[model samples]
Target: MMKNYHNSSLSLPRRYAITAVQAAAFFYFLHCSFLPFPAMQFPFPAMQCDLELSQNVIEAYIQIEEDKIEPMQTESPQYMSTWTWAYMQSFQEPSWHRALYKHLLEKLGKCSVLFFPIISKEEFHFTLLTFHKNERKWRHYNPLRSLGHRKEERCIDMARNFVNIVEGWLEYIRPQAQVFIETKKKPTLVKQKEGLPTLVQKDLTPTEELTLNWIMQNPLQFPFEDDMECAQQSVSSLDYGMFVMFYMDKIAQ
Candidate 1:
């Protein structure tokens, strides 16, 4: 008969040591798989470590380049969103629309006129109209003109008609008004007044200075001279009244 042998031949201490070694080896394999050293070799490729290293280097380089770039200088608000900032910058340069509008105004001889009744200041009106020496009647162009019964229901029909007229005029004059390059004057630097308090000063003509002094002296009286020519070319009551009000406001401030 053979002698019976015990299955627990190895001691508990030895089993514990073997289990700890296996656990350590498994964790070491995992670590090497994810973060392998340049000199180390593993059963599987260490793609995770290589990818992370490359991505980190690229991100660092991009951050450095972005930090070196200077901010754009503009009159727009500092905290404006990206799209708004871009839109504002788009209009900063001269455009064809602005050029066309300026040409149209020059051709039309447009002027802003303020009218007030001779006896009363209550009938003050400001109008934008084209001035024509040959034409007997004034041509008033009110883009906001409407025939709607309610004030709020007014539409921009007049404005649309005006735009169509401008387009037709442009087409008619396209051949003669072809775009041509004009030489522009170089910008000159203005010397700052050093060691002086900031003050607003304007160089006025003799006539302007005399008129201003007279207006200041006789703020309430009418500014028109007795001569017929002077009366014909006299300043508008609305303009004179506005100037007086502005002066008073400034004094109060």
Candidate 2:
């Protein structure tokens, strides 16, 4: 499938990136008449933010879908199949094969909170389109803004691979779930450190422990002659400190 797509067309994703030259543009993309969907009344239960989508975005998508249904009644079924595949490809970021590799990661001062436990940002535009999907859970509307571009078959395969990677990470974190569950069942014993007041809990999250351990194991000890700035910091002690507030009972232990 990939080989055939690579050989025949610009692939769905790549073609979608640049203006013009896409398969949809040739086969009456915005050319077909549009059936207007009522403007955002509600995402599911409640209406989203006050901002409605641009008129062009709404009309462009609606017209794109009408032609596929229009052809189903006619004699040209083969063309319809091609059309269906082409439309799906248009949703992907790019119709071309490679990615633009740019180093976006920059260390802004550390932040730890509920939503963002650790905020390591890279240089990329942050899209702000939020919508709740279901009754119980609300998730970010479109996360694809962060993804690299790809051609059609490559895009599909990459999407599947990404989900598999996430599944593996969840599997890896399964054991850590026991920490929270078991902590509630039985109070954990602590081995207090000797001498000074500094202390940290043993049951830090996997990420926290890994970060502290990596810093300790590989000290950022560059020679005075070295000019690298990535490793340097204003407050080295606090920057490397691990916060374990697990034992702190504010009311009175």
Candidate 3:
């Protein structure tokens, strides 16, 4: 006797369970492929600044980049990833403007703080609009001015400082990066097979060379000179601030 074709002896509960599992699997694939779940409110939990630093602070606004070598994953063992920090300057001097600068410098004098020249964004913006013949519309807004706050006129340092400091103390103690100067090194030649053919030595800008001189003086040694090549690449590519603070709790420790 052949088996009962469509009427198997499987229990009713087993049949229902199979159907339910199939439905769940179908919905899971559908959601994964097509549904546009609310654009993942980025970063899980948002970052919150220390209230003390946010209130009446001059905001040193340091843009730091640290190259991290990731552990073995897949076929590659090492990957380069960046870590950033923006150190805020404390409310120190009586004169808001002068204090603005003194605090910046004081932090640099502590450790691994170096100086470098940056582009003139204000001038570049003016030039860009002057020559922009395209039809793209540009909107410029000043949040502070819109709120009826007068713009303060002051002279700020063209060269900014980068400080490497400890973490978790921004709420209490003032931060610092204490820098030292040492002799500069010669350019390094790298042989390349692609792009501009021929081997070329990467030359340092005068500012970078000078900064290297200053950074080498620190007793707390860092692999800065070796990383200078990569650092230059980072500075050119990234939209970074003038003042930078490097937190060294993880990398340095």
- Alpha-carbon deviation at 80 in model 1, angstroms: 34
Rate residue 216 of model 3 by lDDT.
Answer: 41
Across residues 113-185, which tens digit of lDDT does each residue of candidate 1 receive? 1111011111121112221222322232221112123421222222233334444544543432212101112
Ordered by TM-score, highest first, the candidates read: 2, 3, 1
Best by lDDT: 1
lDDT of 3 by residue, 1-253 (tens): 0112144221122343344345334443333232111122213222111111211111221221222322111111110111111112223222222322223223322223222222222211000000000211211111111112222011012111221221112211221212211222322334367653343334333433332333344333222121111111121221111111111111122
Q: Is candidate 1 or candidate 3 better by lDDT?
A: 1
Comparison by TM-score, 1 against 2, better one: 2
Q: Rate the local accuracy (lDDT) of all candidates.
A: 0.25, 0.23, 0.21
Looking at model 1, residue 121 earns an lDDT score of: 10
lDDT of 1: 0.25
Instruction: Give residue 103's lDDT in candidate 3 (0 to 100).
Output: 30
Ranking of models by lDDT: 1, 2, 3
How accurate locally is residue 181 in candidate 3, as Cα lDDT from 0 to 100? 19
